[model samples]
Target: MSTSAGAYTYSMASNYNRVPKSKVVGISGSEVIELVKRRLLKTQLVKMFRLLQSLFQ
Candidate 1:
């Protein structure tokens, strides 16, 4: 029984390994683009804030 259970788990793991990384992570191109855009906007905002602080000082 233990051996059969172990074999079943091993088969499942092998199947998972065969799956695509993007599908497993569930992130599509659109989601990735949005994430990148958000990151860029955050960095731009931070830079602008820093510039304003430097000007004020």
Candidate 2:
């Protein structure tokens, strides 16, 4: 877990001011078998806005 955390910064850093995105992956002794991906900021913002609009309707 520590190694994964350390690698996240380097592996995930894009441009400054950009929202960082990553997936929590599951590995089994050098083999990856599971991954949980995340939506980007734009997608998240859009979803939130849509939900807010629906609530007001």
Candidate 3:
């Protein structure tokens, strides 16, 4: 959903089905950004691990 200021907000459906949800981000007159999966934390952790490995190597 969007507000009067044009900022959009998204949420997941709380139903009996165990389906996953996605998030969307966009700017005015720009290409829309879509998050097909909810893996933000995992992605960050992977990145950090790679960085640490590189440093140790």
Candidate 4:
């Protein structure tokens, strides 16, 4: 007898041919918006710093 239930599982060959779904975690609209904001801010800051360095040189 098996020690655990549903221990013996078959591969995809046993089932019908179909595309499987992808699962993603830890993502939301608010999180996406926050990431975009951070990237934009960083780009602006880098450009400003480069301009200052060039002027001083």
Candidate 5:
């Protein structure tokens, strides 16, 4: 009879969340689209606020 710790070696790549390197770099189509959506929405909102400020100024 033998009992020992069922140890497993730590690994990163093996369990990586796999957003491919290109996706992480925002090079792929979906990532590019998401990036554009994020930036455009932010800039649009900023511009709208600036316009509103000018209108009230």
Candidate 6:
């Protein structure tokens, strides 16, 4: 085996907490909706702040 392959084998053997390849990670539907809401609110607040700054200047 090549040096890289041997290193990969050694690393895999040394790590016992690795996640399986078949298992997928993701957010739930409600979490995604909440994340989008928070993002939109943050953007709107930033735009309002910028407008106020321009008005005051």
Among these predicted structures, which one has the highest TM-score? 2
The collision pairs in model 6 are none
Q: Write the per-residue lDDT of candidate 3 for residues 1-57, one digit (tens) a residue.
A: 322122332343432343323345544676666544343556656877999999999
Best by lDDT: 2
Q: For residue 27, what is the lDDT in candidate 5?
A: 50
Backbone collisions counted per model: 0, 0, 0, 0, 0, 0
Residue 45 lDDT in candidate 1 = 62
Model 6: per-residue Cα lDDT over 1-57, one tens digit each: 112223244334321243211212236865522221112345556877999999999
Per-model CA lDDT versus the true structure: 0.39, 0.62, 0.48, 0.37, 0.37, 0.39
- Candidate 5 local lDDT, 1-57, one digit each (tens): 112112232112121442211211135755534321212345556877999999999
lDDT of 4 by residue, 1-57 (tens): 212223132221221333222222235865622221112345556877999999999
lDDT value, residue 32 of candidate 4: 26
**Model 1 lDDT on a 0 to 1 scale:** 0.39
Model 5 accuracy (lDDT, Cα): 0.37
Tens digit of lDDT per residue, candidate 1, span 1-57?
112223234334322233211212125765633221112345556877999999999
Worst 10 residues of 3 by lDDT: 1-10
In model 1, what lDDT does residue 26 have?
23
Model 1's TM-score against the true structure: 0.32
Count residue pairs with overlapping backbones in model 2. 0
- Residue 27 C-alpha lDDT in model 2: 79
User: Candidate 2: what lDDT?
Assistant: 0.62
lDDT of 2 by residue, 1-57 (tens): 323355565466553455545556667898986465644778767877999999999
